[model samples]
Target: MSLAAAPFTSLPTPLPAPERTKTRLLELIKRHGPQTAQDLAYKLEVSVPAARRHLCDLQDGGLIESRTERPGGRGRPQHVFALTDQGEASFPKTYSGLCVDVLRHVQQLFGQGAVMQVFDARSAEIAARLQAEVPLSAPLPVRVQAFVRVLCEMGFDAVLEQDGDTWLVSKRNCPNLTVARQFQELCVSELTMYQTLLGVPMTRETRIACGQSTCLYRIGP
Candidate 1:
């Protein structure tokens, strides 16, 4: 699984040249694992001093940490820099790819019925959790807000909007996009889950899996 670089959280919106270099340094550590300043300097094509300065800054910002290690327990110790949890979050993950592969294997081995069972099981689990966390007994607006919050917590980037009496919940990004693209049954399972959680019939206005900008659900007044 290849790691794609994302904008650094520790840096400002408009990253300066030095900060951009720091971002690259984080990417290097993320892609290649722990590395010494000398190794990073060579990879980055910068002087040792410059690399050390960037490493120092990143360390201070709590993105990377260093520990001393000696090669094969011989010779002097060298400091090795590695990404912290915050640093690891600065890159795009390939979890969806792994999930797609697993689902594909399941379908190939046990057939489509088995795949449907997987989706149904996952949907039931999500429904149970939402039933527990969200106040389904509350008013529609309250339930909608809570549902959107839960979706955001699940990495959906969900938002709730109102157009007169109707309400729309939009998911800006689908975390399971890779899997949904291959097996759209996952989408039907999601829509069913939303209706079950909201206790109201909802219509999908647009679908990300269908190449729309967002997965939009409209709740009638």
Candidate 2:
């Protein structure tokens, strides 16, 4: 996907420009594989010195590794850079994989109808799993707190907002939405199931702003 078409959380932010640059460099490596400094400079449109500075920074961050390359009759070796496991983590590939993993698991459970039942089932499963990790004897709000924490750990920017007698469980960002549009319904159903499992009476409203571009799940009790 074009950078502009990426999910909201994947969008480049104004803050942390240096870290973002390093991430962009790693993305380039992941996309094009290994490359020398000159290649990176030309692709990124930066001076050789500036590219080297960013490369060094990324190396320091443990996101990339460099190895010496020698041509058949080269007078000197050049350093070629590529992504390391740690570096690859900075990109959305891992999150995309997680999305696929979850969907696969859901498909196994619900068969061809997984698209319909998987979301709610997964949410219920997550709630059950999380209950084991935290003290469950607490009040409803405390339990919801535990649920939100688990959601955040699972890479959802989940938040619970109070609105009078009801609570709104909202996710501002989901990393998998861009590449997994077929599974968008899963997110909605899962969020709905989360509300049900939380023992809160809730109403769900789903809004698709564009064709697989933006999805909003608003759940309120």
TM-score of each: 0.67, 0.48
Q: How high is the lDDT of residue 146 in model 1?
A: 90
The list of candidate 2 runs beyond 4 A from truth reads: 1-86, 91-112, 117-125, 133-135, 207-221
lDDT of 2 by residue, 22-121 (tens): 6677778998888888898898888889889999988887889999877454868877998889877766646666777777776777785766665566
Tell me which residue pairs clash in candidate 2. 63-87
lDDT of 1 by residue, 41-146 (tens): 9999999999999999999999999998786789998889999997887788788888889999999999988888899889999899779777678998888889
How many clashes in each structure? 0, 1
| Sliding window of 10 residues with minimal summed lDDT for model 2 | 207-216
Off by over 4 Å in 1: 1-17, 31-62, 65-81, 89-93
Error of 1 at 187 (Å): 0.5
